[model samples]
Target: MENTIFSLIPPFLAIIMVVLTRRVLLSLGVGIVSASLLLANFSLTGTVSIIYDAVKGIFVSEGSLNTSNIYILLFLIILGIITSFITISGGSRAFGEWAITRVKSRVGAQIVTIFLGIIIFIDDYFNALAVGQISRPITDRQKVSRAKLAYLIDSTSAPICVVSPVSSWGASIIALIGTILATHNITEYSAFSAFIQIVPMNLYVWATLAMVFIVALRNIEIGPMKIHERRAVKEGLVSDPNKPAVDKLQEDLPTSKKGSVGDLVWPIIALIVGVVGTMFWTGIVGSEGNVSLLAVFENTDVNTSLIIGGLLGLAVTIGFFIRQVLVYKSVDKSVFKKGVWAGTKSMLPAVYILLFAWTIADLIGRLETGKYLAGVVEIINLNHSFLPLILFVIACVMAFSTGTSWGSFGILLPIAGDIAAATDISLLLPALAAVLAGAVFGDHCSPISDTTILSATGAGCNLIDHVMTQLPYAVISALIACFGFLVIGFTGSTTLALLTIVVLLILFVIITSRRTKEV
Candidate 1:
């Protein structure tokens, strides 16, 4: 099972169960047990040990605490608390009212979310959570579904970061490219330059971004997203009432009549400033000497920065809570404890889901699911012209199965480099670009993906609803990207491939808008 077809069973089982049951934790739990069983060869004690070690590993790795995972979980709680106070201070309500007057239309609300998502391209995690906080109130006021908002956040977060050279994703990829270039004895182009060149080659990013804007502007809700839009438009329910959401705890919280938009805007500003400041600080501190922008991003501790930012945001929110109760006298002092608890409680679901996801992802890694998939790709003798397309599909499967785009990058990028170097060195960048695109595509579709979970959490959407609704759009963009990769593989023309993708995307938007009911 470690490096064979059997390794694929656990993740697929979990994913299929999630689609069928619409229960994220249960599905992930089942997947975890299944993976442990497979890894233990059906032995009860071995299975238990494997499960224990995997769960334990989430917090402790190699005798030290897994600060990254722990910090991320803490940040979510802090974000939740901040959200609670923001709502209690009437910031959310006030912002919604203000946005209603200014935005005026559903399309405008969606566009604002997309724009924010694109602008905050430093890290996908920050973009997903922060943009959701800023855009959710506006989208809610405009009757936009949480699922659609999640789609916008998810699509924008990774797709934008993957292409931006100054982003954490770009930094990691450049570092990997540097190592791969060195290993293959290829030095014609520096890693940074190669990364810049491949930016245009990541067709999925452009396709997904185009699809997001087109869907927003044209009011095209494809597949299950249509149902969500219909519900939001007709019934005024942004989220599914029957499902559990990350923001559900704030539903009944008291709000102040005296609250102003500054209550919301100021804390978010602090969060952004704190996080970016910390990112720079960490990156500079971690670097050996003479640092550049890319070095800062590459060396920055994202989870630590997030927690520090979350703390700053939380403090600012608490100050607002105090002002509402003390200065304005609009909110009751008695609501303080209740509001804090509710806010903290709201993020518990996201935390539990992340914990389970991390556990299952660990087990899947132990099974070598991605390695097996890569091995299968390596054995297949195909024409060099098809290598880019083949790598794209394989990378998609690997990232989807493993539920981590970074993990896919670590596993498949070197393999892609080696294969391209052996067959046709000229195809190296194209092949690498395919892997990057495929990994993001796969990450978008995976239920266990942290970015997917964070997007849904940030939007206050049901996890399953987010996953199901975004599937068709992700698939559409991926299909377009696949065609682009096919074109790139054969013709080696990034320009022609991009042109084909843009043309197909426009046709898709036109056809879908004509057929679908407008929200």
Candidate 2:
């Protein structure tokens, strides 16, 4: 069966279903079954076979057994364990009690959340759960909307990870770049050099971060976000208290009498230190004396390194809990195993959604959705000036439809790379950079995105509310990024273009601030 534009029906159908019914799981299920039907040539029996095969592959064979999946599973379990242990030890409660005093205003609480997000930049998952556990209670007390808290949490998660070179996200990106470059036999640029070059060109990421700060700092709310904020302020409703919260682990573990700031602070610090240190050790041992940080990332097995680091962090949490029980006699030693089990159970929903989302993404690839999209560019004779902008838009639309940034990167990077190879080789970095930026932008808006799910879970917000409230801000930042990209496309100067984005971002803040006052 030939893959055509019709291959795109599944994702669109999924998005529409989610919009109409607000049922993410059902929407995704429909997407998978419908897409399977298409792949099976519309035979009902064939669709059943396709579904069974996909389930087996994801759970029984390739998907679960793959190195990347193993690492992620291990990391998730350890993360669950660490968060549960710390929360049960009363660290989360103590931190909230301590933070509430200093963070008296909503702006103060948001700034604290932003800083907490930046400080824990090793992995987006770590940042999402840790920041959410620690910040939600404080934000709630300050009457900040769950949507607003979710927006801050979501923005910082993937965007922060993407920018930081020492992160798991960076490792995946570098590996992808290396694989594509090797496969294409392109020697004009080294992966390391190219990745470094691509960072500055990633406009959507930096712009999104800037938007988060501006929104938090100046108290600018528009669209659905405005309604939420106004409701929070006027009615004293921070979020839907009735909604099922993602912070169940925080409650299930049960707080202890020996609550203190040290309980929360040390465990998080240990996790950071353990992950970074282990990553370095793994890289050094693998590199055989290649000490450059990026070299270690390039040489190191990312899955193995993260799992080891997560284990070390888990060990630290266990040790802290045991000592707390012995010293303070205020903690329960019994909660340890049950807490870990409960935490692991909580992540199953997220895990299933991730697997299904991956399945949809795979189907999209087999169907050549990106190729169909890339063909649009192939026909047009775009010059250098319009090329980056066009590539950015394609990447955005493709990524938005698919609801996965890395998947979009996997599909679009190679095509964009090919386009660059055929045209001016200088377009290589910019083209790749454009894909990275636009993918993150689109993922920001996607309800089914794994990062978005984690963000909602971490912040204890309704997922639909998070998606609705954050979309406007994401669009504004993306529009600004598009403008900056156009400036770069025309002038071929990254500095000037970046400056233009910053200037526009500042102007947007000022204008919105004045508008809010007037209203």
Candidate 3:
């Protein structure tokens, strides 16, 4: 009993610290330290040994910087470099300028912004920054609140990427599913197969997308976000208090080189082509020449594909530089360095977050906390007929605590997958869907979530401000998803269940819009 209680201490403390401090790194550090202290308390060697071991385990253990985490971090850095290059070369600005010319109304601008976010569907981190940067000017020009812009960016980032077949998120989910399948002795099951099976069942992903469209089209305003939206309409985009006034001056100054639609369109095309080509070559061509696309995804790993895509992005950047230099009859070294610096700097925060998340996961695993937690979950009634709802809540809680959808999925997939297999449940679809939905729920709501922070940063909104404003909508969506899962679990009709939620959510948004108008 005492040991069980001690085991729960770290996670509880971690949650409290995050809620109190709202600093992810600090919260993670506190969680790790608390876990170490608890482990020491349980062990004969006491607190010092536990602390030393935890620190040493991170640096010295092979498990600490394993292949998957290393690959993810490397990909993040590469993506950062690529994005930075694009931004420095004025691609993002060009896109924004082009969007402003094309979009006629504030509503149209918001819809287009959300549409572009949906189309990107590559990486959430990339989506968050890229969409925010590209659309910020357009949203600003239209008098849309920065908070609303951040919400749009945040809404699309994880939700769309998680559901897309040709993205980093797709790759991670597939890999996790594959791990689950292999662990459960299901050799016939594949990641892509599992992904397709679960995609329809991913209530939160579909519902969130539905909510985005409904909110945009109906112009629904609720909670703290409603207040911010009204305020921004009255006063204009709020400047960041932390940034220097000089930065504001630079942003306000007029530009000599205005970007055209072609400048924006071609690069985006090139990026999409590169990503698709790489995935096709690696997933389709490399396998049996005639396998289905879904089969290929199940069989192939997307990390390698993304690396290829990054190289392709580099090539495209080089081509753009050449074209510019030749067209102008001049070359500037400063421009090249500027692109590199921008990409590197933009990616630094993600890199740091990844490293810290990895270290914390490793530390927790070493202390056997995750395993023990897994056992405790199994020991409970989490595997019953209503297991789907249990899994949903568990996933949401884990993800909320961890501040990462990916990490939450990583932790819960195996446990949920195994339980699903043992119970003769069609575990592949619902289990995977539950984890995915839960991760998004947590990612959406957690104040410390990296994507949430990135959304705020990209939109130039306050971090806490974004969190407070966004929470109510996220809660509503999560509750709806939870109810949807319950219906699916009982009736085994995922499509109907999701459709019902969609209709209900749409109605809710329309009604809310009317209510706001009346108020």
Most lDDT-accurate candidate? 1
Instruction: Sort the predicted structures by lDDT, highest score first.
Output: 1, 2, 3
Candidate 2 lDDT = 0.79
Q: In model 1, where do residues sit more than 4 Å from their true spots?
A: 517-519
Q: Candidates' TM-scores?
A: 0.98, 0.89, 0.76
For residues 105-133, could you state the per-residue lDDT of candidate 1 as single tens digits?
99999999999999999999999999999
List lDDT for all candidates, in order. 0.93, 0.79, 0.67
**What TM value does model 1 have?**
0.98
lDDT of 3 at 132: 65
Write model 3 residue lDDT over 1-519, tens digit each, in one string.
123545556656765776677565687677767766665655646655766665555445655544444554555555555545444445557766666777867788789789878987766765775576567767877777777888888999899988887676786678778777777777665677778878888898787887778777777777777777776677774443442210111222122143334444455456556656766666676566568665465455455655665566667765665555556434454566655555556555545544555555545555544345446557776435566777787777766655667777777788888787778456457866887898888878765566776677567566556777777778888888888888887777887778779777877877786787788
In candidate 3, stretches whose alpha carbon ends up further than 4 angstroms from where it belongs are 1-15, 22-24, 39-94, 122-137, 161-197, 243-265, 284-292, 299-308, 311-315, 318-343, 367-377, 381-385, 410-414, 417-432, 447-466
Q: Per-residue error at 56 for model 1, in Å?
A: 0.7
Indicate the residue-level lDDT of 450 in model 3.
64
